[model samples]
Target: MRKKRQDFHFTGENNMIRRLVATLREYIPSNRGYPLSVDDGFDETALCARLEERARKGEEASRMVRLREEKRLGELFEPESIVKHNLLKMVCIDEGCMPPYIVQSESMGGNAGTWGSFPCVGANFIYDRMGGKIEHFGNIQYAPRHLINGKFAEGTFKLACKIDFHSIPPSTQYRVVKTPSFTPATDIARQALEETVEQYNKIYGINLLR
Candidate 1:
């Protein structure tokens, strides 16, 4: 079988450098490539590696700051009370159909509770695939402010997510899920999310969120 290109998955700073130099080469007389690099005798390849290193270091620093400041209610796959799961209580509007309060996955990403029978899949983060979290914490149609993770002067508005409970059918929640994901067209939503991911890649010049 033919081997894959070595840089096929190097969607990082080096890839950026390659694009930048390639573009410059088109306009400049440097047939080899752009002479861009750190203050050293390093070639394009070496410069690419160094740029990637600095980019990684920057990401690490930002992640550290987030970890230090972000004291959230849950960890990955683990529901922490007052964080996401239990704090997000679901009361049924359809009486005699199901219990008033919906049971959440006691363990994060394990069972994810259930809508009567069908089980939930994947990590139970602040929000599911659909903008369920937004609906979860507010009466307004959409409240995506909570999606941002950082210190904000928004004050109580940041953590306050008092939303409405849905009187949706269990069967609907089981597979179709939320109105937007079920009513209009599920395939459409998936397509939109994917298209957005593609747009993101093009904007940032990186093949991620795929």
Candidate 2:
């Protein structure tokens, strides 16, 4: 009588090898930009040789170290950062064009039980002082509510942003205040405003308000 053939089942070890191969396949890039295929099975001899070579090279990249360096000294700016930079300069516009105005006063305040709106204005005054060349000025008003712990201040003039002297360019970028003479142009305009307010009863006269 012929003996019954012994049955063989490749179970746990086979499964582990299959799983590793599947994982390697998944890790490989498949996009058109990075072509990789799974048909290249791992060669234990080649891998051992490669491991020895790599160990001898003693070179490896540390992602954490690279990240820390970037955090400390990254020169690149995010889109938001660039936008805010331009906003602070008041020169952000399409295709980098500057508005011809100077920032004068940007303040914030509000009353009880109500939020406040922001009002911004720029004027051409500084340029006129420099041989009838019209310069510009600006003012921003807003009200934001915040306080120590739980109580908000009422009707307090908080300077939201203050640019002692700001000049808007013909293009959308800010140039620093040039010359001591140019530096005081806005101050002169502000003085002129003060004079007008004193001469008249209104805080902002029609000529200066615009």
Point to the candidate with the largest TM-score: 1
User: For model 2, what is the error of residue 55's alpha carbon versus the real structure, in angstroms, after optimal superposition?
Assistant: 68
Give the per-residue lDDT of model 2 (tens digit) for 1-210. Answer: 533423233323445444544465456666543433423433433444454444334223233433443443234334333222322222321111123222223222222121223222322222223122221223212222211111211111111212233456221111221112233334553343333223222211222122
What is the Cα root-mean-square deviation between model 2 and the actual structure? 23.1
lDDT minimum window of 10 residues, candidate 1: 152-161
lDDT of 1 by residue, 1-210 (tens): 533323323444456667764564355443346542322233445545666777677568655644532333233224432223222222222211111212231231243333333343321222333322212323222335654343211111111111124544322222212122222224543453334223322332212122
| Cα displacement (Å) at residue 9, model 1 | 12
Error of 2 at 132 (Å): 34
User: In terms of TM-score, how similar is model 2 to the real structure?
Assistant: 0.15
Against the true structure, what is every candidate's RMSD? 21.4, 23.1
User: For each candidate, what TM-score against the reference?
Assistant: 0.26, 0.15
Q: List the residue pairs that clash in candidate 1.
A: 73-83, 105-113, 137-161, 137-163, 138-163
Q: Lowest lDDT 10-mer window, candidate 2?
A: 152-161
